[model samples]
Target: MTSSELWSRATAERYDAEESENSSAAAVEPALAFLAELAGDGRALEFAIGTGRVGVPLRARGVPVVGIELSEHMAAVLRRKADEETLPVVLGDMATTVVPGTFTLVYLVYNTIANLLTQDEQVQCFRNAARHLAPGGRFVVELGVPPLRVLPPGQVAVPFYVSDHHLGFDTFDLVEQTLVSHHFTRDGEDGRYRRGSCRQRYAWPAELDLMARIAGLELEERVADWHRSPFTGESTQHVSVWRGPSPARP
Candidate 1:
């Protein structure tokens, strides 16, 4: 299936319930604190604002929140959670969508950047974030580190999660720098599993730093997780913040 089709109506309907851990307080608190601190009293823009999962809570915290989503069905899911007046959404691709007003904070969370499957498109996404930010505005990203470690010597696929209700794993194309995530969920009493899959053009942390620099942003902080922990070799995911230049700088 294509990348755009990944967020189909059926998927949108089940997203929150199936990935409840992402919406949990424990998973979301660190991100909330960091973004809110950067935004202060200014507005924040969320790319791929699926179901308003993080946006809704951030808005409730008093930071004005707006969204750009490529899938109408996904936005429809978010609409059910919030009204247009409270949390307005624009139906367009985050990479190219131009919403009204500049933002103090523009963010893409939950590894949403991986949805753009090409390197050029990924660079465009960074440019897009810079375009929307006001001077000194910040762009935050939360993503998993590429799982090359799992694929030792000749291995191609490795399991990341195994459980009763869900089974998650990834297959890598080392030469192409791409990976496909395959997920299976057992939601019925009959014990049959439903499968969903998506592809991502993975990038290294240093490569992302270069992309940010190319897009007129500078790396401000790199944390191992949402809790602002120090990054290390063993960390699986990262929450990175990049900033546009200050008024006098560039």
Candidate 2:
């Protein structure tokens, strides 16, 4: 059985089929507004910009945006949406890929950072984000908080979502701070389930902040979502911003 993954051709082909936040203009508009405000006449860079779902819409808002993608298959899918004149994307990994020039804002959204699968690699991702940022520029990340609290004693798995078309859950290795998302979707005409998995290393909010600190970034703001709602204990995910040092101080 074939399953979709970050670097898989099948995943690239069906990446946008789901009704995710990227699928709706209502959800994307607020994110565009937030990013455009931070961009402020400077360019923005997106890490792991799979299929231009956000980049195309962000560019439509008049913000100049470039992207770096690890998978050429996924980048190819993005090319169908917009040409280089509208959105230029480079083929490279977010943890180490470098594009010439700095950006006023660099963002990794939709839990993409979790794809790194290790703490050291995740820190490298933060450093890379800082490397792309101009003085006083900000790095924004949309990530889910680990679902550890929901786990009862001796339970290593948690169901994150269930719907008529899909059932999604996560299995964790707490000691290693690692997790894998298991997704079963009924895309077949016969209604048979197709399984796909993505493994990631989950980090706490504070741990991510520390990674930012190591990368010479400071925590600026953290919200529940793109709406800028205050993050609370009940919030499962966060949209966080970390600012690089101002030029005068650097």
Candidate 3:
């Protein structure tokens, strides 16, 4: 509902290059396979489909995929890869956008739900997904577990990635369930780092399940990753599926 979090054109231009590793075949294939299986001869919808990293390939795998994107800059980058006919992308917020069609599968990946920045907006996202689902269809989400356990005492930030050119860390506001991810990337050989930050609201698995319930959905399956790994206490992320109610017989 808020454009305050919309990604900037500069960020969109560099998004693919900066996230090259994640868009690689190895990193994306497992998720594609998992989603393809769930799609099962029905169409799929992607929330926050930035640059078509997953949607483009999923469509290539023979599944029809539509996207809802909040950032025009991001959608423009996606347009460069696939035309509107091949992969239709509606420019709007994922929390309330309606694309005028039902889907057998609706999915949000890479901790995108946290981008909503508020519990109410996130819950509305679940409701929106439910609204687009055909009877018995599923909504899937891939999110990271909050890293609070790593904060021993008064520590506020948790470093996720550190390298010669890029440094990534997250600072948490536990009281508000919000965190700001800070990224510093070195450009060329300049030895200077470009700093960028994104604010997001973190949620627990149980809280997400409750959101699904509020949207008239039921938890179906949950795993640590697309590979079906068991979600143990030590897991850093999760892939969860919630199914919509089936239609009643006449």
In candidate 2, residue 77 scores what lDDT? Answer: 90
The full ranking of all candidates by TM-score, starting with the best, is 3, 1, 2
Off by over 4 Å in 2: 1-6, 19-21
Candidate 3 on 145-238: residue-level lDDT in tens? 9999999888999999999989999999999999999999999886999999999999999999999999999999999999999999999999
Q: Give candidate 1 misplaced runs (Cα > 4 Å).
A: 1-6
Q: What is the lDDT for 10 in model 1?
A: 95
**Better candidate by TM-score, 1 or 3:** 3
Which should have the higher lDDT, number 2 or number 3?
3
Cα lDDT tens digits, model 1, 187-211, are 7799999998988888888988999
lDDT of every model, 2 decimals? 0.89, 0.89, 0.95
Cα-based lDDT at residue 240, candidate 1 = 93
**Each model's TM-score?**
0.96, 0.95, 0.98
Best by TM-score: 3
Candidate 1 global Cα RMSD: 1.8
lDDT (10s digit) by residue, model 2, range 50-148: 998888899988899999998888899999999998999998788888999999999989898888877778899999999999999999999999989
Better of 1 and 2 by TM-score: 1
**The best candidate in terms of lDDT:** 3
Decoy 2 TM-score against native: 0.95
